[model samples]
Target: MKRGFLEACVLAAISGEESYGYQIVKDVPASMGLTESTLYPLLKRLEKAGCITARSAEHNGRLRRYYRITDDGRARIEEFLAEWPSVREIYTYVEGAHHDAR
Candidate 1:
């Protein structure tokens, strides 16, 4: 199943020890299999909602803005986790029985 739209940012923040846009673009596919365009706007919204923050850093001699999840972002992840069981069950059942040609 495709990860939820915002899931990339949350996981990316956690994985990067805090990360910037390029890092997220690189890591998200490994974590969530999402593309840069899909993840960037969600990060922007998370920032706007105070669910994350960013600061500039030097990496490979280029400046980049790194992101960290806020307390609220953590809370949101918890909420998503709480809801995951039902979502997972539904998808699992659907996929298992779906298009079976036996």
Candidate 2:
């Protein structure tokens, strides 16, 4: 997936509730094959974009920064969800083509 599209998925992962970077890494599919390096920069970009917010909380004697979706983020997610059906249809068509090649 493109970086911008993947960022939307990251936003979706946080939509249900606030979550830490590590938790999100686990929650999002391994197929997305995310890493801290890729994710943290995306998180920072989202924060800058006003799509998300970060708050630090004490946990296990350490401060963990949690990412929460903002109203803008919700709007963005809604937009992506609305746009996803077309993307899904493309994927389905591509997959069918790949299968026919076998």
Instruction: Report the C-alpha displacement of residue 95, candidate 1, in angstroms.
Output: 2.5
lDDT of 2 by residue, 45-64 (tens): 99999999999999999999
Q: Give the number of the best model, judged by TM-score.
A: 2
Tell me the spans in candidate 1 whose CA falls farther than 4 Å from its real position: 1-9, 58-61, 99-102
Best by lDDT: 2
Q: What alpha-carbon RMSD in Å does predicted model 2 have with respect to the real structure?
A: 2.1
Q: Write the per-residue lDDT of candidate 1 for residues 58-91, one digit (tens) a residue.
A: 8799887888888887777777778888988998
Q: Whole-model lDDT for model 1 versus the true structure?
A: 0.71
True-structure RMSD, every candidate = 3.0, 2.1
Please list all clashing residue pairs in model 2, or write none if there are none. none
- Clashing residue pairs in all predictions, respectively, total 0, 0
TM-scores across all candidates? 0.72, 0.82
